[model samples]
Target: MKVLMIDDNELDLLISRKLISKQVTSLEFTEFTDASQALFYLQELQENEFDIILLDLNMPDMNGWDFLDEYQKLDAHKANVYILTSSLDTRDKLRSREYEVVKGYFDKPLKSNYIAEIINSQQVY
Candidate 1:
């Protein structure tokens, strides 16, 4: 499976990669510390090039929400997006429901069970 992770924090990216790798053996990761850079990368890819997109809501320049706005305009394959955020606010979770491409919302420092679930969900597709 191919995964694109967009997060500003390097530590979080490393941790997420570790957690996800534990669940998926045949995994390919494309990580970005900048949301805009990720978006640009996505533009060049073909359909199904990425199987999943783990996005962080809190970012420096372009937040996850802004990324989603631009992502919606792209005439590219819309990979299933999972919001991996530290925000516990119900409002944020509720807001995520507005995005059709978003598949799930998970907390930071991703749990083992969540990684398993993500892997299983991807298999369904």
Candidate 2:
């Protein structure tokens, strides 16, 4: 499976990669610290290049919301997108539902169990 993670924090990205590697093999991860760059790659790349997108809600230039907004403009197919954010506010959760592509939401300090849940739920082999 091909996964793309868009988070500004390098540490979070590294930790996520580590956790993912421990659970799944033959999974290719493409990470981007910049949401805009991630968006650009998605826009230009061939269709179905990524199986899942783990996105951060709060980012620098282009936040997750903004990225979703622009992402909607493109012809990207139904790539599973999960909001991985630190915000626990109800409003954030409520607002995330507006985007049809958002498959699930996860709190930051990502747990391996949560990753396993997503993987198991999706059965993305």
Candidate 3:
């Protein structure tokens, strides 16, 4: 599976990659520290080029919410997006539900069980 992970923090991205890689051995990752650049990449992606998108809500230049706004303008693709954020606020979780493409909301320092859950849930689609 191909996963596009957008996070401003390099450590978080590295940790997520390691954890997720351990769970999904056949995974391919495209990491981005900048949300706008990631959005630009997504704009040019072909259909099903990526299976999932793990997005961080707090970012510099463009936040996850801004990215979603632009992402919605693009033609639909098969990528299921999950908000992998550090925010513990219920309001943020509730806001994520407003987006149709968002499949799940997860906390930072992503756990192995969450990766397993993502894998299992993805297979059902």
Which predicted model would earn the best lDDT? 1
User: Positional deviation of 21 in candidate 3, in angstroms?
Assistant: 1.0
lDDT of 3 by residue, 39-118 (tens): 88877767548888999999988999999888888885648899999898899999999998899999877998889988
Clashing pairs in 2: none
lDDT of 1 at 39: 88
Query: What lDDT tens digits, residue by residue, belong to model 1 across residues 14-112?
Result: 999987787677899999999999988887777558889999999999999999999988887788899999997889999999999999999988999
Q: lDDT per model, in order?
A: 0.91, 0.88, 0.89
Residue pairs that clash (backbone atoms under 3 angstroms), model 1: none
| TM, every model | 0.95, 0.93, 0.95
**Candidate 3, after superposition: displacement of residue 118 in Å?**
0.8
Better of 1 and 2 by TM-score: 1
Clashes of each: 0, 0, 0
Stretches of candidate 3 exceeding 4 Å from the true structure? none
Better of 2 and 3 by TM-score: 3
Flag clash pairs in model 3.
none
lDDT score, residue 9, model 3?
A: 95
Give the poorly placed runs of model 2, Cα more than 4 Å off. Answer: none
